[model samples]
Target: MHGRIRTWGPGALVLLPTVLLLGYFVYGLIAWTFNTSLTDKHNARPVPTNHVGFENYVNLFGEERFLNSLKNLGVLTVAFIVGTLIFGLIWALLLEKGVPGEGIFRSVFLFPMAVSMIASGVVWGWLLNPSQGDDARGLNRLFSILHLNFLENPWWTGGSRWTTMASIALPAVWQLSGYIMALFLAGFRGIPPELREAARVDGASEFKLYRYVLFPQLSPIALSALIILGHMSLKLFDLIYAITGPNQFRTEVPSVYMWNTLLRSDMAKAAAIAIVLLAVVAVLVIPYVAYTVRQENEE
Candidate 1:
Protein backbone atom coordinates (compact mmCIF):
# COMPACT_ATOMS: atom_id res chain seq x y z
CA MET A 1 0.00 0.00 0.00
CA HIS A 2 2.87 2.35 0.84
CA GLY A 3 4.59 1.58 -2.46
CA ARG A 4 1.32 2.19 -4.42
CA ILE A 5 0.82 5.47 -2.56
CA ARG A 6 4.38 6.54 -3.36
CA THR A 7 3.79 5.85 -7.05
CA TRP A 8 0.42 7.68 -7.28
CA GLY A 9 1.00 10.33 -4.58
CA PRO A 10 2.42 13.01 -6.89
CA GLY A 11 -0.57 12.95 -9.28
CA ALA A 12 -3.02 12.83 -6.38
CA LEU A 13 -1.35 15.79 -4.69
CA VAL A 14 -1.55 17.81 -7.94
CA LEU A 15 -5.30 17.21 -8.21
CA LEU A 16 -6.05 17.88 -4.54
CA PRO A 17 -6.11 21.70 -4.75
CA THR A 18 -8.27 21.67 -7.91
CA VAL A 19 -10.75 19.32 -6.25
CA LEU A 20 -10.76 21.43 -3.10
CA LEU A 21 -11.24 24.64 -5.11
CA LEU A 22 -14.15 23.17 -7.03
CA GLY A 23 -15.76 21.97 -3.82
CA TYR A 24 -15.28 25.36 -2.17
CA PHE A 25 -16.43 27.40 -5.14
CA VAL A 26 -19.16 25.23 -6.64
CA TYR A 27 -20.33 22.58 -4.17
CA GLY A 28 -20.22 24.92 -1.18
CA LEU A 29 -22.56 27.44 -2.84
CA ILE A 30 -24.95 24.68 -3.85
CA ALA A 31 -25.05 23.45 -0.25
CA TRP A 32 -25.64 26.98 1.02
CA THR A 33 -28.49 27.51 -1.46
CA PHE A 34 -30.02 24.16 -0.54
CA ASN A 35 -30.02 25.19 3.11
CA THR A 36 -31.46 28.59 2.25
CA SER A 37 -34.32 27.04 0.32
CA LEU A 38 -35.43 25.20 3.47
CA THR A 39 -35.71 28.48 5.37
CA ASP A 40 -38.40 31.18 5.19
CA LYS A 41 -35.94 34.04 5.21
CA HIS A 42 -36.61 37.13 3.13
CA ASN A 43 -33.29 38.66 2.11
CA ALA A 44 -34.75 42.01 1.16
CA ARG A 45 -36.40 42.48 4.54
CA PRO A 46 -34.84 43.22 7.95
CA VAL A 47 -35.27 40.09 10.06
CA PRO A 48 -34.29 36.63 8.70
CA THR A 49 -37.00 34.06 9.43
CA ASN A 50 -36.57 30.49 10.62
CA HIS A 51 -37.00 27.18 8.83
CA VAL A 52 -40.33 26.80 6.98
CA GLY A 53 -40.09 23.30 5.56
CA PHE A 54 -41.65 23.07 2.04
CA GLU A 55 -44.11 25.94 2.28
CA ASN A 56 -42.14 27.94 -0.25
CA TYR A 57 -42.27 25.08 -2.70
CA VAL A 58 -46.03 24.73 -2.17
CA ASN A 59 -46.47 28.42 -2.77
CA LEU A 60 -44.35 28.22 -5.93
CA PHE A 61 -46.56 25.47 -7.32
CA GLY A 62 -49.73 27.34 -6.36
CA GLU A 63 -48.76 30.40 -8.41
CA GLU A 64 -50.16 30.49 -11.95
CA ARG A 65 -47.20 32.52 -13.25
CA PHE A 66 -44.76 29.95 -11.90
CA LEU A 67 -46.65 27.13 -13.61
CA ASN A 68 -46.79 29.08 -16.85
CA SER A 69 -43.06 29.71 -16.67
CA LEU A 70 -42.43 25.97 -16.30
CA LYS A 71 -44.64 25.25 -19.30
CA ASN A 72 -42.80 27.88 -21.32
CA LEU A 73 -39.48 26.38 -20.29
CA GLY A 74 -40.63 22.95 -21.41
CA VAL A 75 -41.74 24.26 -24.78
CA LEU A 76 -38.50 26.23 -25.29
CA THR A 77 -36.38 23.26 -24.26
CA VAL A 78 -37.99 20.91 -26.77
CA ALA A 79 -38.02 23.42 -29.61
CA PHE A 80 -34.45 24.66 -29.06
CA ILE A 81 -32.99 21.16 -28.65
CA VAL A 82 -34.68 19.78 -31.78
CA GLY A 83 -34.04 22.83 -33.92
CA THR A 84 -30.39 23.24 -32.93
CA LEU A 85 -29.53 19.56 -33.29
CA ILE A 86 -31.17 19.07 -36.70
CA PHE A 87 -29.87 22.34 -38.11
CA GLY A 88 -26.39 21.83 -36.64
CA LEU A 89 -26.15 18.27 -37.94
CA ILE A 90 -27.19 19.35 -41.42
CA TRP A 91 -24.68 22.22 -41.41
CA ALA A 92 -21.90 19.91 -40.20
CA LEU A 93 -22.72 17.31 -42.85
CA LEU A 94 -22.66 19.92 -45.59
CA LEU A 95 -19.33 21.32 -44.38
CA GLU A 96 -17.89 17.80 -44.20
CA LYS A 97 -18.90 17.20 -47.82
CA GLY A 98 -16.85 20.24 -48.95
CA VAL A 99 -19.81 22.22 -50.22
CA PRO A 100 -19.31 25.41 -52.24
CA GLY A 101 -17.76 28.26 -50.28
CA GLU A 102 -17.61 26.01 -47.23
CA GLY A 103 -15.33 28.40 -45.38
CA ILE A 104 -17.66 31.35 -45.93
CA PHE A 105 -20.67 29.30 -44.95
CA ARG A 106 -18.96 28.14 -41.78
CA SER A 107 -18.02 31.71 -40.87
CA VAL A 108 -21.54 32.99 -41.47
CA PHE A 109 -23.08 30.24 -39.38
CA LEU A 110 -20.58 30.66 -36.53
CA PHE A 111 -20.58 34.47 -36.47
CA PRO A 112 -23.78 34.60 -34.44
CA MET A 113 -22.11 32.61 -31.66
CA ALA A 114 -19.28 35.13 -31.42
CA VAL A 115 -21.69 37.93 -30.56
CA SER A 116 -22.89 38.42 -26.96
CA MET A 117 -26.28 36.89 -26.15
CA ILE A 118 -27.72 40.35 -25.46
CA ALA A 119 -26.53 41.60 -28.84
CA SER A 120 -27.93 38.56 -30.58
CA GLY A 121 -31.25 39.10 -28.83
CA VAL A 122 -31.34 42.75 -29.83
CA VAL A 123 -30.56 41.94 -33.45
CA TRP A 124 -33.15 39.19 -33.62
CA GLY A 125 -35.78 41.39 -31.95
CA TRP A 126 -35.29 44.03 -34.61
CA LEU A 127 -35.44 41.45 -37.36
CA LEU A 128 -38.69 39.99 -36.01
CA ASN A 129 -40.51 43.27 -35.32
CA PRO A 130 -44.00 43.16 -36.84
CA SER A 131 -44.76 46.86 -37.42
CA GLN A 132 -46.21 47.64 -40.87
CA GLY A 133 -46.63 50.52 -43.41
CA ASP A 134 -43.79 52.64 -44.91
CA ASP A 135 -42.03 52.51 -41.54
CA ALA A 136 -42.29 48.68 -41.56
CA ARG A 137 -39.02 46.87 -40.89
CA GLY A 138 -37.86 43.28 -40.43
CA LEU A 139 -40.31 40.41 -41.09
CA ASN A 140 -43.15 42.90 -41.48
CA ARG A 141 -41.61 44.54 -44.54
CA LEU A 142 -40.71 41.24 -46.17
CA PHE A 143 -44.23 39.88 -45.58
CA SER A 144 -45.78 43.10 -46.98
CA ILE A 145 -43.63 42.81 -50.13
CA LEU A 146 -44.89 39.26 -50.63
CA HIS A 147 -48.51 40.40 -49.92
CA LEU A 148 -48.51 38.19 -46.84
CA ASN A 149 -49.44 41.05 -44.50
CA PHE A 150 -51.40 38.72 -42.24
CA LEU A 151 -48.09 37.39 -40.92
CA GLU A 152 -47.17 40.87 -39.69
CA ASN A 153 -48.80 40.85 -36.28
CA PRO A 154 -46.71 42.30 -33.40
CA TRP A 155 -44.54 39.38 -32.30
CA TRP A 156 -44.28 40.60 -28.72
CA THR A 157 -47.99 41.34 -28.35
CA GLY A 158 -49.59 39.73 -25.29
CA GLY A 159 -52.36 38.12 -27.38
CA SER A 160 -49.89 36.02 -29.40
CA ARG A 161 -48.02 34.18 -26.66
CA TRP A 162 -47.15 31.18 -28.81
CA THR A 163 -45.75 33.38 -31.57
CA THR A 164 -43.64 35.26 -29.02
CA MET A 165 -42.34 32.00 -27.58
CA ALA A 166 -41.41 30.77 -31.05
CA SER A 167 -39.74 34.07 -31.92
CA ILE A 168 -37.48 33.85 -28.85
CA ALA A 169 -36.69 30.21 -29.62
CA LEU A 170 -35.70 30.99 -33.19
CA PRO A 171 -33.02 33.45 -32.07
CA ALA A 172 -31.73 30.94 -29.51
CA VAL A 173 -31.41 28.29 -32.21
CA TRP A 174 -29.72 30.70 -34.60
CA GLN A 175 -27.09 31.63 -32.00
CA LEU A 176 -26.49 28.12 -30.62
CA SER A 177 -26.78 25.92 -33.71
CA GLY A 178 -23.39 27.07 -34.95
CA TYR A 179 -21.65 25.84 -31.81
CA ILE A 180 -23.50 22.53 -32.15
CA MET A 181 -22.42 22.32 -35.78
CA ALA A 182 -18.78 22.75 -34.73
CA LEU A 183 -19.12 19.85 -32.31
CA PHE A 184 -20.70 17.63 -34.99
CA LEU A 185 -18.10 18.63 -37.54
CA ALA A 186 -15.34 17.67 -35.12
CA GLY A 187 -16.95 14.26 -34.64
CA PHE A 188 -17.44 13.79 -38.37
CA ARG A 189 -13.87 14.76 -39.18
CA GLY A 190 -12.50 12.27 -36.64
CA ILE A 191 -13.97 9.33 -38.58
CA PRO A 192 -11.33 7.26 -40.37
CA PRO A 193 -11.23 7.64 -44.15
CA GLU A 194 -10.68 3.88 -44.45
CA LEU A 195 -14.19 3.20 -43.07
CA ARG A 196 -15.81 5.42 -45.71
CA GLU A 197 -13.65 3.85 -48.43
CA ALA A 198 -14.61 0.34 -47.29
CA ALA A 199 -18.29 1.27 -47.24
CA ARG A 200 -17.99 2.74 -50.73
CA VAL A 201 -16.17 -0.40 -51.92
CA ASP A 202 -19.12 -2.44 -50.67
CA GLY A 203 -21.42 -0.29 -52.85
CA ALA A 204 -23.12 1.42 -49.88
CA SER A 205 -25.32 4.32 -50.92
CA GLU A 206 -24.65 7.74 -49.26
CA PHE A 207 -27.88 7.68 -47.27
CA LYS A 208 -27.38 4.05 -46.17
CA LEU A 209 -23.76 4.74 -45.22
CA TYR A 210 -24.76 7.68 -43.06
CA ARG A 211 -27.73 5.90 -41.54
CA TYR A 212 -25.97 2.62 -40.76
CA VAL A 213 -22.28 3.37 -40.46
CA LEU A 214 -21.81 7.00 -39.49
CA PHE A 215 -24.66 7.54 -37.04
CA PRO A 216 -23.77 4.62 -34.77
CA GLN A 217 -20.27 5.99 -34.33
CA LEU A 218 -21.66 9.46 -33.63
CA SER A 219 -23.60 8.37 -30.53
CA PRO A 220 -21.00 9.57 -28.05
CA ILE A 221 -20.84 12.94 -29.78
CA ALA A 222 -24.62 13.10 -29.89
CA LEU A 223 -24.78 12.35 -26.17
CA SER A 224 -22.23 15.05 -25.47
CA ALA A 225 -24.22 17.49 -27.56
CA LEU A 226 -27.42 16.55 -25.75
CA ILE A 227 -25.83 17.12 -22.37
CA ILE A 228 -24.59 20.57 -23.39
CA LEU A 229 -27.81 21.55 -25.15
CA GLY A 230 -29.90 20.26 -22.26
CA HIS A 231 -27.94 22.30 -19.73
CA MET A 232 -28.18 25.44 -21.90
CA SER A 233 -31.91 24.97 -22.35
CA LEU A 234 -32.38 24.35 -18.65
CA LYS A 235 -30.50 27.49 -17.57
CA LEU A 236 -31.61 29.69 -20.45
CA PHE A 237 -31.83 33.37 -19.39
CA ASP A 238 -29.93 36.08 -21.25
CA LEU A 239 -31.54 35.86 -24.68
CA ILE A 240 -35.06 35.45 -23.33
CA TYR A 241 -34.56 38.24 -20.80
CA ALA A 242 -33.11 40.57 -23.40
CA ILE A 243 -35.52 39.90 -26.26
CA THR A 244 -38.62 39.93 -24.08
CA GLY A 245 -38.82 42.37 -21.21
CA PRO A 246 -38.89 41.10 -17.62
CA ASN A 247 -42.67 41.50 -17.25
CA GLN A 248 -43.52 39.75 -20.50
CA PHE A 249 -45.64 36.74 -19.55
CA ARG A 250 -45.43 35.16 -22.99
CA THR A 251 -41.65 34.65 -22.92
CA GLU A 252 -41.18 33.82 -19.26
CA VAL A 253 -38.67 31.01 -18.47
CA PRO A 254 -37.52 29.56 -15.16
CA SER A 255 -34.47 31.75 -14.90
CA VAL A 256 -36.41 34.90 -15.73
CA TYR A 257 -39.15 33.84 -13.35
CA MET A 258 -36.60 33.29 -10.62
CA TRP A 259 -35.25 36.78 -11.25
CA ASN A 260 -38.73 38.22 -11.06
CA THR A 261 -39.38 36.43 -7.79
CA LEU A 262 -36.17 37.72 -6.33
CA LEU A 263 -37.04 41.25 -7.44
CA ARG A 264 -40.45 40.91 -5.87
CA SER A 265 -38.86 40.07 -2.48
CA ASP A 266 -39.87 36.42 -2.64
CA MET A 267 -36.45 34.97 -1.88
CA ALA A 268 -37.73 31.76 -0.38
CA LYS A 269 -40.02 31.11 -3.32
CA ALA A 270 -37.24 31.99 -5.74
CA ALA A 271 -34.92 29.59 -3.97
CA ALA A 272 -37.60 26.90 -4.15
CA ILE A 273 -38.01 27.44 -7.89
CA ALA A 274 -34.23 27.34 -8.34
CA ILE A 275 -34.03 24.08 -6.39
CA VAL A 276 -36.77 22.65 -8.57
CA LEU A 277 -34.88 23.69 -11.68
CA LEU A 278 -31.71 22.09 -10.33
CA ALA A 279 -33.63 18.89 -9.64
CA VAL A 280 -34.98 18.83 -13.17
CA VAL A 281 -31.47 19.05 -14.61
CA ALA A 282 -30.24 16.40 -12.20
CA VAL A 283 -33.10 14.05 -13.12
CA LEU A 284 -32.22 14.38 -16.78
CA VAL A 285 -28.41 14.16 -16.42
CA ILE A 286 -27.90 11.70 -13.55
CA PRO A 287 -29.21 8.71 -15.48
CA TYR A 288 -27.02 9.43 -18.47
CA VAL A 289 -24.01 9.88 -16.21
CA ALA A 290 -24.71 6.60 -14.43
CA TYR A 291 -25.11 4.78 -17.75
CA THR A 292 -21.81 6.17 -19.00
CA VAL A 293 -20.06 5.10 -15.81
CA ARG A 294 -21.48 1.59 -16.12
CA GLN A 295 -20.33 1.36 -19.74
CA GLU A 296 -16.88 2.57 -18.77
CA ASN A 297 -16.64 -0.07 -16.04
CA GLU A 298 -17.80 -2.77 -18.44
CA GLU A 299 -15.23 -1.71 -21.00
Candidate 2:
Protein backbone atom coordinates (compact mmCIF):
# COMPACT_ATOMS: atom_id res chain seq x y z
CA MET A 1 0.00 0.00 0.00
CA HIS A 2 2.77 2.39 0.93
CA GLY A 3 4.71 1.66 -2.26
CA ARG A 4 1.63 2.07 -4.48
CA ILE A 5 0.65 5.30 -2.77
CA ARG A 6 4.18 6.66 -3.15
CA THR A 7 4.18 5.81 -6.87
CA TRP A 8 0.77 7.46 -7.61
CA GLY A 9 0.86 10.17 -4.94
CA PRO A 10 2.48 12.92 -7.04
CA GLY A 11 0.02 12.52 -9.94
CA ALA A 12 -2.94 12.50 -7.51
CA LEU A 13 -1.62 15.60 -5.74
CA VAL A 14 -1.27 17.41 -9.10
CA LEU A 15 -4.75 16.39 -10.32
CA LEU A 16 -6.71 17.02 -7.11
CA PRO A 17 -6.69 20.83 -7.06
CA THR A 18 -7.41 21.17 -10.78
CA VAL A 19 -10.26 18.68 -10.55
CA LEU A 20 -11.68 20.43 -7.49
CA LEU A 21 -11.45 23.83 -9.20
CA LEU A 22 -13.18 22.52 -12.32
CA GLY A 23 -15.86 20.75 -10.34
CA TYR A 24 -16.65 23.89 -8.37
CA PHE A 25 -16.21 26.53 -11.02
CA VAL A 26 -17.59 24.74 -14.09
CA TYR A 27 -20.07 22.14 -12.89
CA GLY A 28 -20.95 24.17 -9.84
CA LEU A 29 -21.67 27.16 -12.02
CA ILE A 30 -24.00 25.04 -14.15
CA ALA A 31 -25.79 23.79 -11.03
CA TRP A 32 -26.12 27.34 -9.74
CA THR A 33 -27.61 28.46 -13.04
CA PHE A 34 -30.13 25.62 -12.81
CA ASN A 35 -31.02 26.72 -9.29
CA THR A 36 -31.32 30.32 -10.39
CA SER A 37 -33.75 29.30 -13.09
CA LEU A 38 -36.06 27.99 -10.38
CA THR A 39 -36.29 31.36 -8.65
CA ASP A 40 -38.01 34.74 -9.02
CA LYS A 41 -35.00 36.85 -8.10
CA HIS A 42 -35.05 39.76 -10.50
CA ASN A 43 -36.96 42.84 -11.61
CA ALA A 44 -40.35 43.44 -9.89
CA ARG A 45 -40.64 40.26 -7.92
CA PRO A 46 -41.67 41.18 -4.31
CA VAL A 47 -39.88 38.36 -2.48
CA PRO A 48 -36.65 38.17 -4.46
CA THR A 49 -35.16 35.33 -2.42
CA ASN A 50 -37.96 32.86 -3.16
CA HIS A 51 -37.86 29.84 -5.44
CA VAL A 52 -40.68 30.16 -7.95
CA GLY A 53 -40.13 26.64 -9.32
CA PHE A 54 -40.44 26.86 -13.14
CA GLU A 55 -42.83 29.80 -13.31
CA ASN A 56 -40.09 31.56 -15.23
CA TYR A 57 -40.12 28.73 -17.74
CA VAL A 58 -43.92 28.92 -18.06
CA ASN A 59 -43.73 32.66 -18.66
CA LEU A 60 -40.82 32.22 -21.11
CA PHE A 61 -42.67 29.62 -23.18
CA GLY A 62 -45.70 31.91 -23.37
CA GLU A 63 -43.72 34.78 -24.86
CA GLU A 64 -44.06 35.45 -28.60
CA ARG A 65 -40.42 36.53 -28.83
CA PHE A 66 -39.22 33.30 -27.27
CA LEU A 67 -41.34 31.23 -29.64
CA ASN A 68 -40.05 33.24 -32.60
CA SER A 69 -36.50 32.76 -31.44
CA LEU A 70 -37.03 29.00 -31.25
CA LYS A 71 -38.50 29.04 -34.73
CA ASN A 72 -35.54 31.10 -35.97
CA LEU A 73 -33.12 28.65 -34.38
CA GLY A 74 -34.84 25.75 -36.13
CA VAL A 75 -34.55 27.53 -39.46
CA LEU A 76 -30.92 28.45 -38.94
CA THR A 77 -29.98 24.99 -37.71
CA VAL A 78 -31.59 23.25 -40.69
CA ALA A 79 -30.24 25.67 -43.29
CA PHE A 80 -26.73 25.86 -41.87
CA ILE A 81 -26.31 22.13 -41.26
CA VAL A 82 -27.80 21.05 -44.60
CA GLY A 83 -25.99 23.72 -46.61
CA THR A 84 -22.63 23.10 -44.96
CA LEU A 85 -22.80 19.34 -45.33
CA ILE A 86 -23.96 19.32 -48.96
CA PHE A 87 -21.50 22.01 -50.04
CA GLY A 88 -18.71 20.53 -47.98
CA LEU A 89 -19.31 17.05 -49.33
CA ILE A 90 -19.37 18.45 -52.86
CA TRP A 91 -16.11 20.30 -52.30
CA ALA A 92 -14.52 17.22 -50.78
CA LEU A 93 -15.58 15.02 -53.69
CA LEU A 94 -14.37 17.53 -56.28
CA LEU A 95 -11.01 17.84 -54.56
CA GLU A 96 -10.77 14.03 -54.27
CA LYS A 97 -10.60 14.05 -58.10
CA GLY A 98 -6.91 15.07 -57.76
CA VAL A 99 -7.47 18.26 -59.71
CA PRO A 100 -4.66 20.67 -60.47
CA GLY A 101 -4.01 23.39 -57.86
CA GLU A 102 -5.34 21.03 -55.19
CA GLY A 103 -3.34 22.65 -52.42
CA ILE A 104 -4.30 26.16 -53.49
CA PHE A 105 -7.99 25.23 -53.79
CA ARG A 106 -7.96 23.50 -50.41
CA SER A 107 -6.27 26.50 -48.80
CA VAL A 108 -8.73 28.89 -50.43
CA PHE A 109 -11.68 26.89 -49.18
CA LEU A 110 -10.28 26.53 -45.66
CA PHE A 111 -9.08 30.11 -45.25
CA PRO A 112 -12.57 31.30 -44.34
CA MET A 113 -12.74 28.75 -41.52
CA ALA A 114 -9.84 30.53 -39.85
CA VAL A 115 -11.69 33.86 -40.01
CA SER A 116 -13.73 34.65 -36.90
CA MET A 117 -17.52 34.38 -37.30
CA ILE A 118 -17.84 37.98 -36.06
CA ALA A 119 -15.58 39.11 -38.90
CA SER A 120 -17.51 37.00 -41.40
CA GLY A 121 -20.77 38.47 -40.13
CA VAL A 122 -19.42 42.02 -40.47
CA VAL A 123 -18.31 41.40 -44.04
CA TRP A 124 -21.41 39.46 -45.13
CA GLY A 125 -23.69 41.92 -43.36
CA TRP A 126 -22.19 44.67 -45.49
CA LEU A 127 -22.24 42.64 -48.71
CA LEU A 128 -25.81 41.52 -48.31
CA ASN A 129 -27.20 44.84 -47.05
CA PRO A 130 -30.81 45.16 -48.18
CA SER A 131 -30.93 48.94 -48.50
CA GLN A 132 -31.25 49.97 -52.15
CA GLY A 133 -31.76 53.71 -51.88
CA ASP A 134 -28.92 56.21 -51.29
CA ASP A 135 -27.22 53.65 -49.08
CA ALA A 136 -27.07 51.12 -51.97
CA ARG A 137 -24.04 48.95 -51.19
CA GLY A 138 -22.27 45.61 -51.70
CA LEU A 139 -24.35 43.06 -53.66
CA ASN A 140 -27.12 45.58 -54.18
CA ARG A 141 -24.71 47.60 -56.32
CA LEU A 142 -23.77 44.55 -58.39
CA PHE A 143 -27.42 43.53 -58.66
CA SER A 144 -28.33 47.00 -59.88
CA ILE A 145 -25.50 46.95 -62.40
CA LEU A 146 -26.51 43.52 -63.68
CA HIS A 147 -30.19 44.49 -63.84
CA LEU A 148 -30.96 41.74 -61.35
CA ASN A 149 -32.56 44.14 -58.91
CA PHE A 150 -35.37 41.68 -58.27
CA LEU A 151 -32.94 39.40 -56.41
CA GLU A 152 -32.00 42.17 -54.02
CA ASN A 153 -33.87 41.66 -50.78
CA PRO A 154 -33.21 42.10 -47.07
CA TRP A 155 -30.24 39.86 -46.29
CA TRP A 156 -29.97 39.47 -42.53
CA THR A 157 -32.35 42.12 -41.28
CA GLY A 158 -36.14 42.62 -41.25
CA GLY A 159 -37.72 39.92 -43.41
CA SER A 160 -40.00 36.89 -43.32
CA ARG A 161 -39.07 34.77 -40.31
CA TRP A 162 -37.61 31.83 -42.24
CA THR A 163 -36.09 34.11 -44.88
CA THR A 164 -34.07 36.05 -42.33
CA MET A 165 -32.91 32.90 -40.60
CA ALA A 166 -31.85 31.41 -43.92
CA SER A 167 -30.05 34.64 -44.79
CA ILE A 168 -28.03 34.49 -41.56
CA ALA A 169 -27.21 30.85 -42.30
CA LEU A 170 -25.53 31.80 -45.58
CA PRO A 171 -22.52 33.41 -43.90
CA ALA A 172 -22.32 30.56 -41.39
CA VAL A 173 -22.31 27.99 -44.15
CA TRP A 174 -19.70 29.88 -46.16
CA GLN A 175 -17.33 30.09 -43.21
CA LEU A 176 -17.64 26.53 -41.87
CA SER A 177 -18.31 24.47 -45.00
CA GLY A 178 -14.56 24.38 -45.59
CA TYR A 179 -13.98 22.70 -42.23
CA ILE A 180 -16.68 20.17 -43.04
CA MET A 181 -15.05 19.68 -46.43
CA ALA A 182 -11.78 18.96 -44.68
CA LEU A 183 -13.53 16.43 -42.44
CA PHE A 184 -15.15 14.59 -45.38
CA LEU A 185 -11.97 14.88 -47.45
CA ALA A 186 -9.97 13.24 -44.69
CA GLY A 187 -12.62 10.51 -44.45
CA PHE A 188 -12.47 9.99 -48.19
CA ARG A 189 -8.69 9.78 -48.29
CA GLY A 190 -8.60 7.38 -45.36
CA ILE A 191 -10.36 4.72 -47.49
CA PRO A 192 -7.76 2.35 -48.84
CA PRO A 193 -6.94 2.45 -52.56
CA GLU A 194 -7.16 -1.35 -52.44
CA LEU A 195 -10.86 -1.10 -51.63
CA ARG A 196 -11.50 1.01 -54.74
CA GLU A 197 -9.41 -1.26 -56.92
CA ALA A 198 -11.20 -4.34 -55.68
CA ALA A 199 -14.56 -2.68 -56.24
CA ARG A 200 -13.49 -1.83 -59.78
CA VAL A 201 -12.18 -5.34 -60.25
CA ASP A 202 -15.61 -6.66 -59.32
CA GLY A 203 -17.06 -4.70 -62.30
CA ALA A 204 -18.43 -1.95 -60.10
CA SER A 205 -19.16 1.31 -61.88
CA GLU A 206 -17.84 4.55 -60.39
CA PHE A 207 -21.22 5.54 -58.99
CA LYS A 208 -21.80 2.09 -57.62
CA LEU A 209 -18.34 2.03 -56.06
CA TYR A 210 -18.96 5.28 -54.23
CA ARG A 211 -22.57 4.61 -53.37
CA TYR A 212 -21.79 1.17 -51.97
CA VAL A 213 -18.31 1.59 -50.49
CA LEU A 214 -17.32 5.21 -50.03
CA PHE A 215 -20.46 6.63 -48.41
CA PRO A 216 -20.71 4.13 -45.60
CA GLN A 217 -17.13 4.98 -44.60
CA LEU A 218 -18.04 8.65 -44.30
CA SER A 219 -20.91 8.12 -41.83
CA PRO A 220 -18.77 8.89 -38.80
CA ILE A 221 -17.58 12.14 -40.36
CA ALA A 222 -21.16 13.06 -41.20
CA LEU A 223 -22.27 12.40 -37.63
CA SER A 224 -19.42 14.51 -36.25
CA ALA A 225 -20.28 17.40 -38.54
CA LEU A 226 -23.98 17.14 -37.72
CA ILE A 227 -23.42 17.23 -33.96
CA ILE A 228 -20.80 19.97 -34.09
CA LEU A 229 -22.81 22.16 -36.44
CA GLY A 230 -26.12 21.49 -34.66
CA HIS A 231 -24.78 22.54 -31.27
CA MET A 232 -23.13 25.58 -32.84
CA SER A 233 -26.32 26.68 -34.60
CA LEU A 234 -28.31 26.25 -31.38
CA LYS A 235 -25.78 28.30 -29.43
CA LEU A 236 -25.23 30.89 -32.18
CA PHE A 237 -24.62 34.33 -30.72
CA ASP A 238 -21.51 36.32 -31.62
CA LEU A 239 -22.13 36.36 -35.37
CA ILE A 240 -25.81 37.24 -35.06
CA TYR A 241 -25.08 39.89 -32.41
CA ALA A 242 -22.30 41.39 -34.51
CA ILE A 243 -24.42 41.68 -37.61
CA THR A 244 -27.93 42.22 -36.27
CA GLY A 245 -27.11 44.16 -33.08
CA PRO A 246 -30.05 42.93 -30.97
CA ASN A 247 -32.66 44.02 -33.48
CA GLN A 248 -35.04 41.18 -32.52
CA PHE A 249 -35.70 40.67 -36.17
CA ARG A 250 -36.91 37.43 -37.67
CA THR A 251 -33.31 36.19 -37.30
CA GLU A 252 -33.30 36.42 -33.50
CA VAL A 253 -32.10 33.18 -31.91
CA PRO A 254 -32.20 31.86 -28.32
CA SER A 255 -28.77 33.17 -27.39
CA VAL A 256 -29.81 36.66 -28.46
CA TYR A 257 -33.06 36.29 -26.49
CA MET A 258 -31.08 35.24 -23.43
CA TRP A 259 -28.82 38.26 -23.80
CA ASN A 260 -31.74 40.69 -24.10
CA THR A 261 -33.58 38.99 -21.23
CA LEU A 262 -30.57 39.30 -18.97
CA LEU A 263 -30.15 42.95 -19.95
CA ARG A 264 -33.76 43.57 -18.78
CA SER A 265 -32.78 42.02 -15.42
CA ASP A 266 -35.14 39.06 -15.97
CA MET A 267 -32.66 36.76 -14.34
CA ALA A 268 -35.01 33.81 -13.95
CA LYS A 269 -36.26 33.94 -17.54
CA ALA A 270 -32.73 34.39 -18.88
CA ALA A 271 -31.53 31.49 -16.83
CA ALA A 272 -34.45 29.42 -18.11
CA ILE A 273 -33.50 30.32 -21.68
CA ALA A 274 -29.90 29.41 -20.96
CA ILE A 275 -30.89 26.16 -19.33
CA VAL A 276 -33.13 25.25 -22.24
CA LEU A 277 -30.34 26.04 -24.67
CA LEU A 278 -27.96 24.01 -22.54
CA ALA A 279 -30.45 21.14 -22.61
CA VAL A 280 -30.56 21.37 -26.41
CA VAL A 281 -26.78 21.35 -26.63
CA ALA A 282 -26.71 18.46 -24.19
CA VAL A 283 -29.21 16.57 -26.38
CA LEU A 284 -26.77 16.84 -29.26
CA VAL A 285 -23.54 16.37 -27.33
CA ILE A 286 -24.47 13.47 -25.06
CA PRO A 287 -25.44 11.26 -27.99
CA TYR A 288 -22.26 12.13 -29.83
CA VAL A 289 -20.21 11.42 -26.73
CA ALA A 290 -21.93 8.10 -26.23
CA TYR A 291 -21.48 7.16 -29.89
CA THR A 292 -17.81 8.08 -29.73
CA VAL A 293 -17.21 6.10 -26.58
CA ARG A 294 -19.06 3.14 -28.00
CA GLN A 295 -16.98 3.35 -31.19
CA GLU A 296 -13.80 3.45 -29.15
CA ASN A 297 -14.92 0.47 -27.12
CA GLU A 298 -15.81 -1.52 -30.23
CA GLU A 299 -12.47 -0.64 -31.74
Candidate with best lDDT = 2
Task: Please give the CA lDDT of all the candidate structures.
Answer: 0.85, 0.89
Candidate 1 lDDT, 1-299, residue by residue in tens: 99999999999999999999999888887887777888887677778579988888888889899898898888788888988999999999989998989889988999988889888887777887767777789988988899997777676554555666767788889988999998899898999989999999999999999998888889899998898888888898988877877888878888898898889887777888889999999988998899899999999
- Over 138-184, each residue of candidate 2 has an lDDT whose tens digit, in order, gives 88888888888887876766667667888889889999999999999
**How much is 182 displaced in model 1, in angstroms?**
1.6
User: Could you tell me how far off, in angstroms, the CA of residue 46 lies in candidate 1 after the best superposition?
Assistant: 3.1
Question: Ten consecutive residues with minimal summed lDDT in candidate 2?
Answer: 40-49
Alpha-carbon deviation at 79 in model 2, angstroms: 0.4
Evaluated with TM-score, which candidate comes out highest? 2
Model 1, CA-based lDDT: 0.85
